[model samples]
Target chain A: MTLEIETGGVQLSTPILPASGTFGWGTELKNLVDYSALGAVVTKGISLHPRKGNPQPRLLEVPCGLINSIGLQNPGVDAFIQNYEKELSALSMPVIVNIFGESPQEYAEVATKLSNCHWVSGLEINLSCPNVHAGGLEFGSNITGVRDVIQAVRNSTNKPLWAKFSHSTHLFHLVEAALEAGSNAVVLLNTLPALAINIKSKQPVLGARRGGLSGPPLKYVALRDVFDVYSRFKCHIVGVGGIIKPEDAVEFILAGARAVEIGTGAMVHPELFIKCRNFMSEYLKNGSYESVENMVGLAHDDQHV
Target chain B: MRDSPTHFQLTITGNEKVGDRFFLLSFENPGVSFRPGQFAMVAISGEPYPLLRRPFAVSRTPEGTLQILYRVVGTGTRLMSYWKKGRKVNVIFPLGNGFEKIQNACILVGGGSGVASMIALARELHSRGTPYLLCVGTKKSGELDPHSSVFQNPPLNVKFATEDGSFGFHGTVLDLAEQHIHSFTCAAVCGPPAMMTAFLERFPDVNAMFSLENHMGCGTGVCLGCAIETRNGMMRVCVDGPVFPGKILLPEHLK
Candidate 1:
């Protein structure tokens, strides 16, 4: 029955945390679900300074999924500290700050700016952004670039580092590279890079043309990443991508994710954070598992008991 | 941007007329308590296309329910106007900021679906006992649902001006307003861009407020897709004010 995931000054009753950007800021959906219910609320990704983000057509709906190129549009670390930090300081759960940067130094700068802030319990260096076509390459798909950014951010902040990995690359190596760079944990999946076209307009439906796809359609791809990464590495796994239903959460937990992050799922159901909390409890009770720990990786356990 | 993912369930008569192109849906749910010129995001109960909640104005708020007289312009709105009773459709409402009225007398003007927002304004002005006149320009006199009961008259001066003399005045609604423009202190208009432009210029001295309905993403401010340039520079329509005064908006903004 032990479902504790406490470490590095962070304590979670369960491991599931709502992924960044998907949950908006906690205040937006405050009426839908109790903020205190989730293990933690990962704030929307913020940069060193505010960003307005890309032009129109930021989001496009796909089959049971969506492609979003929000471009990490946030108020930046200064504004986050000014407006959201004090409010987050009062919350009971760890307020993990998902951060993004145009360069490795910018990543370190954002982390450093938030380093002394007590509200930020951990740092999730977003290395999986798929919107911008940068340097003729993406930081997410490049393992070496990912390691450099992670290490730079690791050196700048004392908080636990969670590398958000993109699905464009291999799992074992990404997780391995993350750990070698001193990442305390790894969010096993981001969104799969995809494109959607408007047949009538004969042009790309999304303004960014390419976006990260997330939803029920990406659940299996996410689960495979979690399973494969957990099987290869010893670091904590934060399962993410396309977790729509509660059973899907169970699948991620069973696949060896210490915790699961609800990505685009929350956009459809804001109360899903509490929905998963209650559903997972009922599911654990029905399956004769006293707690989430008993269910973690049970899908791969040989005994199946 | 705050996203309260809550849906209100309400089914009532809309006083619908014309082709499936348009209809007046009225409902009195507690969810109807929105600002006069604000909008409600609606989604069809069951549909495959336009999964996002589409924004529409509260055409009228006459106790118990708010009405949105919407025309099917795209896949999103087409599915909404077809929703039947006893069906649970998810709708997030009363979203975004509305116009700031000085709590005085004003004039209300409407055309097409923009009538929805103008009607909502009349209800607010009437509730506040704010002196106001509502003029809904239509293609035919009988083609509308008598958009307002504000005036003592049953049809409330429901005027029209079809080119074929099938309606009132046989001209534009602005023609009717020319006789009454000086009577009102302020004006609020919602409708097609062309009409709004004309209304904005016609009532130069009087405060003319225009409610614009553009396609929005997130329905919240995060998308920044719905922005209009004004004297103060670019302000997000979804976050700032959906109903902007003609004085603040730039000349090309209406275009």
Candidate 2:
């Protein structure tokens, strides 16, 4: 059974990729993770300028999930290329740089610079980072915002573009807007916007006051979004949310995700990529499925009338 | 090139209550030695309630096993307190930067679980034949485990301070260190935020280094959850340091 599959014009050796923000530049965990098991490495979100991120208490662990408000803390685009370009270029697997900006112009400029780097496999447009005050969920809130950013970025580079979206009331329209604006794929669901409060302090727990929730609690919501988008559109769907176990990845695949991105789960279990890969391979062999491509959206076929 | 941290699972050999709130946990050594002040991210093998692993300063026992000195504070630690021997735990080890050795004799001040961060440094100083003093502070005598490996055989020059005056010196650890300020040129400290802040405020001239603790996600640099502002701008506690020079630490950071 071949695990090899293609998403957004980039061929992956496997269907599992590390979600953006969880893996740093794809090189931080080189010694700890098995790179061969991943389809590609999505970097932490990079902005046009360095961001200091949120203050203290940036992360909080809830039941089966984590609420994080990192505020897109990054070294900026130029610095990222300077510090990690050589190592990232040398990696045997593909590198998907996740880009963020405070405005559409800034997003385009950052994309223009990354387009110069030949080793960059694609650009995962971060339209749904809920932690920041600007250019995060704000840019993906409506059709116009999604179109303007994706169109601006698409005009800036010829690289594959995967528009990452957060769960919203009009999630499908946002997916349609991204595809209409030239996004090659849509990453269904970034994180669910959530808030946590400290009862004693009578204030929010996170420095940013609000954060995005990820982990097991997010799995069902993300799977439903993937199914909805897959059934409605002809675009590629990369499932991401709370994928902790191998079976979780399979569930996403059957729900119509061509690929799945491991976020909080990978931080907790670094070997999850390989574990998911192995499990998927066994699942295909046991079920007599020819490839991962065949497994996509299988659950849709079994639905009762 | 610095060696990358390895992820592995180890079986718990011992987990015993030390004091009212502290426990001494040990496991078979994976033959990976850590520098003084380095830490590890640890979690129970199969439990899933507490999603992320907790970071703890690592120490090696005289009996050739690795250990972590921890205090029962929250759900994670409360769960860890019940961990029995033979249970497997996942760990990512030899993480973050360790304390740098100073040339002159120095004073080491540790408060609460921060005392565990000083043990390896003290052991290293003892082996180098460098004269140093280890001053440990606790709320009271019940919070300290005198027989734990952290305070065992070596590192003979020792002192104790307790807020409740149940131990040697009364008042905070910094107040006790002030009595011996003239004896050492430098100091290494790790403890509660208030205690560390006091050390920085009181000893502006004395060369010092502080091992900071923060709520961390990934002990690796990726999470960026443990970032602290410094003279050098924002730096990660998991990578740039769990240890930082006292001079570079901004006053606003500790608070």
Candidate 3:
């Protein structure tokens, strides 16, 4: 079945993309996955300056999820362009640059530099990374803050703008603000903020004391947020969080997401991209759906079929 | 560089106790050959309680059993201790750069549980007809008991040292190696940081290879969790060299 999707003027061959951070710079998994079958490859958050990230014990395992406070570590935008641009250009697939900054101007600066590079297809403004101490989730938790960042980035470049929002209480308001500020689509949901403790040591498990939760525990919350935003605005959504199986991707699409991004699922299974595609192909044929796009918003209609 | 590693589920053959607080967990060998110091990232549990996989050095018995000698230190290793026969665990194999060929007579010094990796190296060198001396060290004699299968039928000259004078030598393994430093042309040391540091200081100009240990996440180049500041630059312990040259490793005191 044709899984083609048009988001921000870029045509995706399939709706399966690996989430930022989980896929590294896309070169690390080049030998593992079939890149031509993928919609796009989103890179880790690139900031204005290189960061050392958090200390040891940066990740902890909970019951059904992972808690991480990696603190948005990257080699900065200039180094990324100089070092990874040549390799990313050879991917033969759409490359979404996930950009982050301490302020709206910094976000624009990153976007502006990326706009000059011919390899990048879209820009995923990372205003919702909950693990960092500043600038990330802070800009995503409010409506005006979201609009300000998106507007600054929008003014800087003509590239496809995807505002990646968090699973915050004010997420709907933030989504509306992103659309108003000229976002072509919204990447619904970053990891949820959470904490874990080591009883023996009586201390926080993560190095940064708290972290963003991902995996099975985050699936329902992300789906609800996608459904809530999609039912109201009818905007394109790139659903993320705990898409381990093809059934989970189907759940997200039925909830009104046009595409799905695999994060922790890829970490647990490196061959997840091929597995998800195989399952989706079989799913589409068995369900008698002409294409993956036909399955979108199935849950929003009056009839179950 | 080698080809991309395949992640597979291998069933446990047995979890036999080889030493005090140490277990030799064997699994069905996937028929892939690996170097002496290379390791695998083994999942402790399929669930998320221990989300990240734990890295272990690859060891094989004389009977052609692929095994890992692990000590119960943390929750992950402790959970690995309880794994039973017939249980399947996911592992990504043949990771990190292993040791290179030893041209001349070599001395293998292993401190504490570091000796687990030495067993594999010893087996490989013996099969290749390389001359080497094996030195195993621990806190006391009980830590390296005679009942352990790892101590059986060692092909080369084997030496031992203990802190309490209960074994071959009366001091640390580095102290025991001092006498034989001039006899061997090369050395390979794997143990606690202090032991490696002392060995480096004693034989500054001698050629030596070291197997390192660190906390790892992906056991690949991605997570960057196992980064070590080397003499050259920031190097990942997982992908760069879990087995590094003596000169490349930054001294512990300087770190």
What DockQ does every candidate get? 0.26, 0.78, 0.38
User: What is the C-alpha lDDT profile of model 3 across B1-255, one tens digit per residue?
Assistant: 443567878989999887678898889988777888999888777665566678889877777788888888878888899999999989888888888866688889999878877878887777778888888888988776645666663454678889888878999898888777678898989898788888888889989999887766567767665565578766667889789899988775222
Better of 1 and 2 by TM-score: 2
Clashing pairs in 1: B14-B24, B27-B65, B28-B64, B28-B65, B59-B116, B160-B168
Question: To one decimal, what is the Cα RMSD in angstroms of model 2 from the true structure?
Answer: 2.1
Candidate number with greatest lDDT: 2
Q: Which candidate should be chosen as best, given TM-score against the real structure?
A: 2
* DockQ top scorer: 2
Model 3 Cα lDDT, one tens digit per residue, A1-305: 67787865567888889888787777886655677658999998899888767655666666667777777778889999999998999987899999988788889999999999999999998886432435345888888778889999999999999999778777778888999999999997898888988899899877679788887778898999989888888889899998766688879988988888988777766677877777777888989888877877778864254
Give TM-score values for chain A, per-prediction: 0.92, 0.96, 0.94
- Candidate 3 has which clashing residue pairs, if any? none
DockQ score for model 2: 0.78
Per-prediction CA RMSD (Å): 4.3, 2.1, 3.4
- Model 3, residue A283: distance off in Å is 1.8
Candidate 1 per-residue lDDT, tens place, B178-245, comes to: 77778777777777778877776666777787787766555655444455557876566765778777
Task: Output the worst ten-in-a-row residue range by lDDT, candidate 3 chain A.
Answer: A128-137
Worst-scoring 10-residue span by lDDT in model 2 chain A: A128-137
lDDT of 1 by residue, A180-249 (tens): 9898888868777888888998988776677777777788888888887776664578888777667788
How are the candidates ranked when ordered by TM-score, highest leading?
2, 3, 1
